[model samples]
Target: MHGPDSLVFKSDRPWPNARLRVGAIVGHATSDSVRLWLRTGGPGRFTLLLYDCGEAMGSSSVRAELRAALGRVPVSAEEAAEALAASRTVPFEVDGYADDTTRVLDLADLRPDTRYGYALHSEDDGGKVILGHNRLRSFRTPPGEDERRPFQVALFSCHMPYRVSGLFRKRTDVGDIDAWDFLAATLDRHRDDLDVVIAGGDQCYSDGVGTLDIWKLLNRSMRREGGELLPDERSMRSWYRDIYRGYWGFEGVRRVFDAYPTYMIWDDHEIGDGWGSHYLADDGPDDGLARVLPDLADRGLTRDDGRRLLRRMFRAACAVYREYQHSHNPPTDAGADPDADADADAERDATGADTDAQDVWDYSFTRGGAAFYVLDGRGHRDIERDGYRILGEPQFRRFEAWADALDPEETPFMFVVSAVPVLHARSALANADLAAPVRAAGIGDDLRDSWEHDLHDEERAALMEVLFRAARRGLRPLIVSGDVHCSAVFSLTDDDGHRVWQLTSSAVTYHVPRALGWALRFGAADDGETPEGYAFRRLALYTGTSYALIEVNPAAREAWFKLYGKQIVEEPGPDRGRRAVPLSHSVAKIRLS
Candidate 1:
């Protein structure tokens, strides 16, 4: 709000009157809570709102029954870890200086393998409930690894700002329009065939698309085809919420997350464009990815500022995500020490499942009879070896432990990693996209190095060394990723001498560039590689936006990638018409065989 005396006031006091929006997320679960999160655009006295199904899990409208089940919880991202550790629930205070706010509501003492329904609300100054209320929502905890039930997941990444309109927006159908639901449909159709979906980051973009304001009018006009646009942080929040709501508010997506299960690892967009913990030399501690946006900006997860917030929020997100699934959900009341599960961790290691002796802690999940270890590629790095680093020493230690725990055939492990494409085969190495002055300028310094620089032979080989571990051990490896915009595939050689596989699906809604896309399709019109330096050794020629549907058999040591064929899938035959032309459905049995 602007006034003579009052400088700039960013508050949720006025809902539609301002840009503060609400973002809700449900991913990777834990015992007590469902990993519930939301953004508050800016700062003020924010209330932790939860809708009471009042009952248990089921087909129930939970709005009316959800009374003032509100907690006077007050908290912020700046609070000391000690404070966060000690408090049960604190009132959330919105920081309106910038255009963001995010908080994780840890609903402890929940039941395992049960579904809990919920919704969000915001009340500034502890005055009145001004934000979302009674909007039906829910999540399920995971069934323990030994629960005897099979596992499944919904692996996704690069979920973006506008699928409704353009420059940055995509031309997607309702099936694709509601991308999350589309993913849910995929999970639904193949519910029995999968365990969980692993999201490999770039889940949302902030520095992308000028601002959220322009995105709003642009979306409203998708149907209207025209509208007066005013893009800014405030507009961005609502636009962002609308975009996220498209995913979470869907029946299919919500049901799957609530029934099946999922795990997410952050990339640049989760916080903002080109964000890194300390990747940038000049960025302030609260720089690009570190700068806080409203929970609305991040759709209620981690903002685009940096990894610190995500690290803070990861434990929280895991809670809700696990609670929604029958698997992974821990008992909230007390005594169900996740430590109890940790108790057998050593035994798993002894069984020759977890194989490393490195002193580091990392996370791994079990589903579909497979173990997915998310090795962080962005923040934690020891980039001192020949100018490039492997999964760093600490993370590498964690990997060794994870590998030792895998029995090759028992629970065949698929490393659902963010950056495990351990090869660099670029045939085309020339050309530049002066694309449009605007785009060339937009991508500017922010993306040039990323898009322009291809991995040198040295770095590629080093990555392969680390990658060889998974292969040498007779494990079929699968890589899920987002940072790059188009869907592509890579091949890896296992230790047992079998050729493993790596699959990459680009931005769910983001694009590299029309010029880059063209270069990606064919070679550079002028040079063989194009203006950007990337080259594809086995770059399968395909087009349109896409994601991946991965299938793995830990026992068989077999894995395959299913590209969204209807959109980009290319293999066509009579049966193909019956099925769909999968863009990159290359399949190969994996083993150290």
Candidate 2:
């Protein structure tokens, strides 16, 4: 493979020409179209050759015809050059300035419930040949809106990439396996298991370990009063892009993405820890993660200064999210072509003082007999003093409208995906006597980040009230989440007899700290008695890395939540060879009434 033109090589890393650094089918998947994302080692024109798998296989002389028509569709190194030259292609040109691009190709009036095969090719801008081509990749169009059949969804989140710029640290004494080994293994083992994949949050930790050095943490004297220990706008953007490139570069993770369409949202770590939790000057001082460089706030900036900085950082991070994650399953409000420009405009508008956390990542879509709602919990957080609203008023109003419009009788199952658990042990800690003492010590203010925080009682109750309204209307809500570094399921029922269930899985790669891990296990255990038919069931809790699979059988009115654990296992050898194992727990099946 030859390299891109000399000018093109200046910006991007050097790589064999035409070979992709990363590729995936992203953005919203409709009956007719899906977005394809690709990044090349160098500048080139990417072309896709699409073929209906069914039609090709149905031919009387499949082998002879395909060979004659497309010349054997070579996958081996020897035959690839010939096959690529003969391949019929659809061109997607990379700008001379950029090597990464996303092309949304129409499926040419594709049929529903059908599989299609696509081969990727690349060439120089002048139609000259380049390097190795992508082998045949295939994806199936989802069933039409009226169709009813069983389907599965894979839910996982919180990937802290290993040793990237030394941001995420691990012990070298023992085997420190990546949790994604389990995710990749699950995708390999359960090849046909899920139709779609949903990543809850913390996909990439931009301001993770390596970003904040000890010098920044200790030396407040030499810095600008209100300036944060953060990168400037340009550096911020570059960091976000690098984080995605490094994290998704893994072949194992890439394979799952290639096989399934993924939908994602961002958490606080996307920008900085506990983002959008700002304190007004009149509200006294900041605390915990909310307390940034206060001297920066004191440096003649307005009370909205923190929020302004947050919005700036968010704008940069949101750019990458729009390109890689939100593009796949954007909010219903975003128009058909949800490009980066549209997202930037929306981010600017949503970043106003009235808006708490800016950037809109909430979205909804339906499949089978169920409707799925992905909530942007991190983006819409109001000040703890401002009634501690978790999802700002605008987001709540949108959710209310969507929920009210749904016919619960027709769509019996309602699935809500929140980055943080809506029902969990956090609620149990609301009334616990820890706040005053903790705050007096000038620490632990980040506890208010949860939905169940005491300051957010009214906010939590309001959200519950709206969800209850949906439950009364006959929609059985199942809230799924993946933060907090632990996995569990809790049942919630109010006095009015409305019942909802919460399932949580977290830390696809990040390991919980020992102190927090012990406390979670000790306090959040499931009591045997289903008191008042409301119970907190500790299905499983591991400080180590894991993921979950949710399978729904629409015909049977049942769903199964399967959790898989990934860990380093010692092989039977004198050297004690170690390997990563992603083994699933016994399936916990539930019947929906």
Candidate 3:
């Protein structure tokens, strides 16, 4: 009867082939604790063992003992699964999830600034067996107050594995190169030097051009007639489960998550294409699917009905998001605290009574000397142009509260993760004559979801003002994002000399269209425009698939962005071979001061 907060290990059924699967992960490490996430093949009990990695402990001796122990033990399938549930000798124990699949363990009593060797084990009625015992891995906790150590973070986004399959036309131009192979090589080479991984957004392309399997699942879930249960709840749950299963299946994503602690946030693709950009207003003629399909505009469902159906679909999607993404982070119980604000409930009522749905993913955490403010920008947006709000009232207030509580002088670097690019090239497709019919039909608003859109000017200004205030207070604001499909570095300095950096790394496995990439880099008038009171610049740009590594040297008072790209190479011979080769010369480095 262990609750969600407490760790429990039980495996009702061992997966048929019991190959451990761990991916789609995010880990948050504090001074004294580390939260770990893992996904298994099937239901079963498992054990996690953590050992201190220090010079005093002879590494060779430890390895020899573990190997000998593993070789001596013999385990049957049922015994392996049952032994995991029955054994309670490990330092930390958790019963596998109901299906004995996924588990998030919050491990305590860990030393700060220390790297600990770790292992996963499966036990059953007959014996105890180690899982992936041969591969060595370790998790490093945050530094203590007196420790000052240079740490590195890996940031990347928009991982759509299906893009390389060429089953979809929009990304047909993508070369045969598989970016994941490059990522796997890069991470393996630099795994020891990396501290934590920050996955900006679009980890799974829930909605994208090439995701046929996802759409197939969704189609099966939806009721053909489109009723209250337009999407069967059971089918929606299975779809989300399969999404994670398929996404974590990638070896690149799996290798990183298995080795390091990752922190993640979601973007439009997590729910659907351009989620929150479409409001489905009940009083408007722009019903949900009708705008896209001309004939359906006046046929079956009314505007109110459409809104209801969309709400249900969104609820289902949010539920899955909460279970997989938000549950691992800091608790959002502040929203329910009565004493915090007497009128909080009233505020929530006026803003729209879905407070839980909107605020669960917005949270703040402190590690070492830096703080992370992760935003749920896509969850609560109100696309109506009248009074535009990208982050509805509740989440915005929560962000303000987190900012107000920060003591900038003590925390020199503040990391803010926004799934979508805050500073982006103005859309060339936003105001085209060919898209006018789509605009008048009420769905064109989705095209203008960026911060620079005229409709969202006020909101963008407000966001900038907050960052300016933070900058003035001595916080070097570094915003990391990934949704644009092209990686770039942009910065803005206000009249007060307050500076903020937007380092966007995107499409870890997909290519940006050559024409659109060129337009974003050169054709746009606002590519490097400076506003009235600020100095703006585009420091670097990369249109190919890549990831950004931000290394902060506190003592030196400097930070730099290292962007890496993958090159496709072909060997010419009778035994022709094609492989992804790391292009060392194309490395783009930009200094932040």
Candidate 4:
């Protein structure tokens, strides 16, 4: 089978000056449309040619035609041009200001359940195509919402890229790329079967304020007073841009992104270790900033200064996130306005103090018999506020409305993506005010980040009730999550026997220590009951670099979740090089009706 890597078009002509930094990533797709995201080396006009895989053509025949058009099977430039001209063409422009030339192009009016092969070409100022080598990326538009068909969705999260400087460091040692390679191979093997790929959270870790270079840069910019010397907006944006590029630029990772329609939501690590959960005041008891920089007090950093710094960081992080990640997501309530000014809509306050209704990141979509609601757990989170909400009031209300409106007859399976698991082992340590102790033990703000954390108990209960209500109404609710660096399946059952499942696939690249893995397993081992009398228990668990495939068979009225873990094996070849392969770790089937 030809993987995404083999689809690259080769030519004797010199490569164009304006090239792709990250490969074309297929994102958020509906039956009629799909979004494609790309980052170029510089600002330029580009045209994407999308060729349909004819209904009568088989997979082999389609590949043969693609190869012939690209000259691999002997075709002239004119013939290739003619073939490409027969396909649909979309023209777009990229600018330097938008996260260094990143753009998301939405292709509309596509045929449902159809496969399309697309090639991107740089265009001249006169609107002529600049012919050169480019990869042929493809994605299949989802089946119509009314259609009840079998489809699969891949879920995973918590991607931490390897760092050479921290080679011996425990964290760095476990940050391997093997999982991504395995994921690429897995997606390629099941290309036709898999429809959507959902990255639960922590796509890239901005841990410890990012890499050594970023740390040094931030440190150098910090003043003793932490007033005037805080890193400027440009510096912060540059640091985050570098982090995203470094983490997502891996060859295997790019291949998977290029091949599938992916959806993503950010976790705390996207901005900092525990962005919304930590105290912002320097003198505050649980101030994560003070703990990370123990000498901040001695350096004369005050509470106000810390607040200002954090605000600046948040603004920069959110701005860049919107450009890189949020651009491809389905339009939000506020973002759906076609007449809204793009620049004005992108701007958010430094503190995020106001509930900018326009800043809503949560979105929902339907495919076949399933409905997916991706909650923005990190964006509007307000642990320091009086309400201590996770999704904040505005987004929470939107979610509630979406849940309330779901029709079991139309969408039998509902998946709620929370990034952090909604149902995990209850953490006793998280209930207490042991922030100082936990920080001393190098856990950072993790304990506070949990849904079980005392601060978020109310919000967690509210979310659970909503899911339970959905289940009672006959919708099979499954909460998909990541960020704990472990994989597990948990089910919540109400008195009426209504069930909701939590499927967690995490640390797609990062490794989990044996002790940590065992601890997670043990904590989730015991069955327990929620405050509302709903019993919950761990169904299956796997601690490793892994991902989950949820296959929905609407005709069967059931879904099968198979967790695949990464296993390193030596290839049987002359070089005898080792490679990572995916091995089935666990499987569970849940009834849809």
Candidate 5:
């Protein structure tokens, strides 16, 4: 029941000065380095103390030590004090311009496959720690690249926090169990086994601009006489910040973020529902927000005015997104140096087909024997101005280079993350021509948001060709995705047996309606062939709130995937009304070799 303003301490030593409410989130991690994101009450200097548990400790022992450090177990005062006195101290500062309350601390030069407990404390002007009560959290560094370690990762997305109508104060969705609560419980039960957690997309929905009070005001303002007097960039930034803080402040969600080295990428909902998939002009038939607000023109808002407002909203969204999500992700080439190659970057931008590496949100990283490339599907999408592109030319070129440079002997496995599924069901309803009509009915943008849509055919072909080429070179390329509100597996196999797989798990917290579930199942029930003559088939489909666990055993050249969620029982039996039981179903097991 703890809110954003509440602080949970690891001990009850009664420290009156420990009043600052802070949130510690473990960000991207490597064998020797890890990033810690902290959100404090306000801007100030702080010291982070990291204590490494001895290498002799086993996984079970490490967990015990962490529990004892958190005051969950009985530990003598002598042991606790000794551990704290032997910690490594690092000082950092947070400032107002950078969103006063948040800062990211990068710690490097740590041992691989090591467990470490950490605590954050506020400091006085004299450089002395002032916080008396602190919360101790811990994370384990991944095994080094040279090590052949068997690791498991959890992947899921579409986290819609339980929302209440701001005007009515009532629930908007079904009430069962919180998905984050289930995920936190699962993490606790298998803490030692899970190495990383990937939140594929839709970490928080900005549908209707969010559920906060400011968002409600914005919604009402949109329906006013002009519908053009929207919140300024500053006001929009504060509202978006409130949305993130409110949504992620739940105890279970906080626990999951703090417990693991989690990575994330943005999808459409992170900006607005179907942000990049529709026409931008208000007068166009396929216009997105115009369709949502059909009377904008009648309300005295011109097409140009609407377009300007959309651009403003986009700017605000990107500003807040960088501060909350992208800051902790690995930096892009252009982002590393904004001034580097300015002339070249400007030349590329003039073509409307190029993007600076920094402007693009795409990033890649490696763990052990596998490499991951997270695509910025929404960030650079341009269906209208560019005549259709999911990943702009520059970002796609970067992806091609990454794939071409991979040495199969050293890294045989590659995971391509497209927040949206690349090979989902193919249906006529998803055609681009039907976008206007579909959107008029309130679901058009979603139908057009797929890789199979006609608008993205060329780009999808290019992406698939690169993956196929990688597979031909003996690299097992697997695409993992979310945002479909269902769990499914698909594969493309050529005559020579060069195969590529796609795994999708989504709606970690949001529920999929029954009719939509049936539609998804029916659409994915068939097999087809790509234009390149490669056979593609849907292997499995589960429509529910679920997450996928992938276990990679590099030594054996094998990987196994398991989807965990509640299974539906159709039979009218005694178990029909019984308590829901979470079950793990084997989805796929593939050989990297």
Candidate 6:
């Protein structure tokens, strides 16, 4: 139980590995907390034969137990399954997945603004030991205090670590920039202007990659001419370790998280081929399949066992984060000067300071007069636009209910967040048709799902209807996202005369391939993204090699999006002398008059 390399959950029956986690990875501040999501790696069979035996909620001593030998009690497998099923502390929701590898533990009635401590547990590692141990981890929760605090926010997203193979772009056209390299640069110049950063998604890759696994058949398909193919699971697993280790393992990005409070989520690359919601089957895993094909989505691969591994990684990390936060509280300064530490001053006015003046370490807090709703888009989303359902019925219901429950009568601004930008780029893409065919192709996302595809028009019609209605009701809607790999702004007019603004920032390091994107010159490409750029008028303003300096004045109902150092694509303006420029996109703030 005390060793690092323990036989996590070794068991007699091994198909259904023993351990699955029930926790979340959260980013926090003193005022509120944001839940990345809570998940459990599932498949109920004879997985890891381990159990979570943490000390009581607030204690250091935990009860460790070895349960794998229970078979000697003469209990039948079904009996044991019943007992285990009855012991869970949280509710479970899962679709049949051959890759029945995960069960998530999401938030239910999470407080609006507050700070919390959180963490997770692991069943396996390197070597031998007991089957049970402590559940405590190093992690902090989203800020939960909504006393109307004042804080700065750093925004960004879209970090695709893989360099595009010639299939999508020319290697000579542009080389890849690691995600951390860009973040370090951004922080170098603008660390003083912000509080925390939020990512839209693509945090990890799911599809087989060349750098990680040149062994899988999937990798063969991914390569330009298709050469080496991974012959087995061991090779595939090796790929998983390589690709993931390459990015998350980056020391620079980890520093950013440690330097500033950060919130993250997953999008397409976290899985594979954008719409895996269409998994073809849910039966137990076979040597041939890694993900489960959803019986519902016409047999699309939705539940890859590989995804569960990634999810487990996310949950475990979050747990470690919670453990860290509780153990190491960041220093706070409340002096009139940002440079001074006012211990006496802070103690005296701790409860009296305006919410707006406090630092945002975890969750959404009331700043100025707006309610910033930052949440997970990929975790809760039901395949988008193809009629697959944007938000699942449950999530959608909750969203509307939350909106209805909002006391708009008392609020002025509503800044909503998704790791991915929510604004529809159809108009911009539509404009691309006027450009070269290759560029026009850029307008169409081959991955558009039921949520954004066949039912896109209807979904848009409905979303506008609700959002506009909310605006008329005095709810200013501002949607922010990050997965697009670019930064920009967008606006929409709702039927109710309400205005919608969207702001997007992508990987402080990752960038789009330059060649496949060459259609830019042929069309109205700004930085080679095409008509979408035309629609948003997105200028790369600053290469993310420099982090973004994002500021939001909740009281004033304004948002400032800027890059910290390098200036590449920017709105037409004078040399402001600052490394960061106010991006025109709504990726960060929502202010309604």
Query: Which numbered prediction scores highest in lDDT against the true structure?
Result: 4
RMSD of each: 14.5, 7.1, 7.5, 7.4, 7.6, 18.0
Candidate lDDT values, in order: 0.42, 0.57, 0.60, 0.68, 0.66, 0.39
| Cα misplacement distance, residue 37 of candidate 5 (Å) | 1.0
TM-score leader:
4
Clashing pairs in 2: 27-327, 27-328, 28-328, 225-295, 225-296, 226-295, 226-296, 226-297
Give candidate 5's error at residue 85 in angstroms.
Answer: 3.3
lDDT of 3 at 233: 33
Please estimate how well model 4 matches the true structure, expressed as its whole-model Cα lDDT. 0.68
Off by over 4 Å in 2: 1-20, 41-44, 54-89, 96-108, 125-136, 163-178, 211-232, 278-283, 287-290, 294-309, 331-359, 427-443, 511-518, 525-540, 567-579, 584-593
What's the CA error at residue 487 for candidate 1, in Å? 1.5
lDDT for each residue of candidate 4 in 1-593, tens digit (9 for 90 to 100):
11121112322212112223646778899889998887765677676767775654456665566555553333433444566554676667775444557778889999988888776656433333222233456788888877788998899898875543345542222246677877877777777768889988888766522333343444445553322434445556656776676677677777888778899889987877666777765455676666545444665666555555566566667776777788888876432222223132223223444323358788888878888999988877766777736788777788999999998888888999999887774632332444344445555356567777777877888888899899889899988999877888878898889999988898787633323333454455446776667787766777777887898976666898878886667888798987665654433444333
Q: What is the lDDT of residue 176 in candidate 4?
A: 65
- Cα misplacement distance, residue 401 of candidate 1 (Å): 5.0
10 residues in a row with least lDDT, candidate 5: 1-10
> Per the 3 Å backbone cut-off, how many clashing residue pairs does candidate 6 have?
117
Error of 2 at 363 (Å): 0.9
What does candidate 3's lDDT look like per residue over 494-547, in tens digits?
876789998989878753242333444443232344433566767787777888
Rank the candidate models, highest lDDT first.
4, 5, 3, 2, 1, 6
TM-score of each: 0.54, 0.76, 0.78, 0.83, 0.80, 0.51
How much lDDT does candidate 2 score?
Answer: 0.57
Off by over 4 Å in 4: 1-20, 55-85, 124-134, 164-175, 208-216, 224-229, 292-301, 333-358, 427-444, 511-518, 568-579, 583-593
Stretches of candidate 5 above 4 Å error? 1-21, 54-83, 124-135, 163-177, 208-219, 222-230, 292-295, 333-358, 427-442, 512-518, 567-577, 581-593
User: What TM-score, to 2 decimals, does candidate 6 have?
Assistant: 0.51
Better of 5 and 6 by TM-score: 5
Task: Report how far off residue 417 is in candidate 1 (Å).
Answer: 1.1
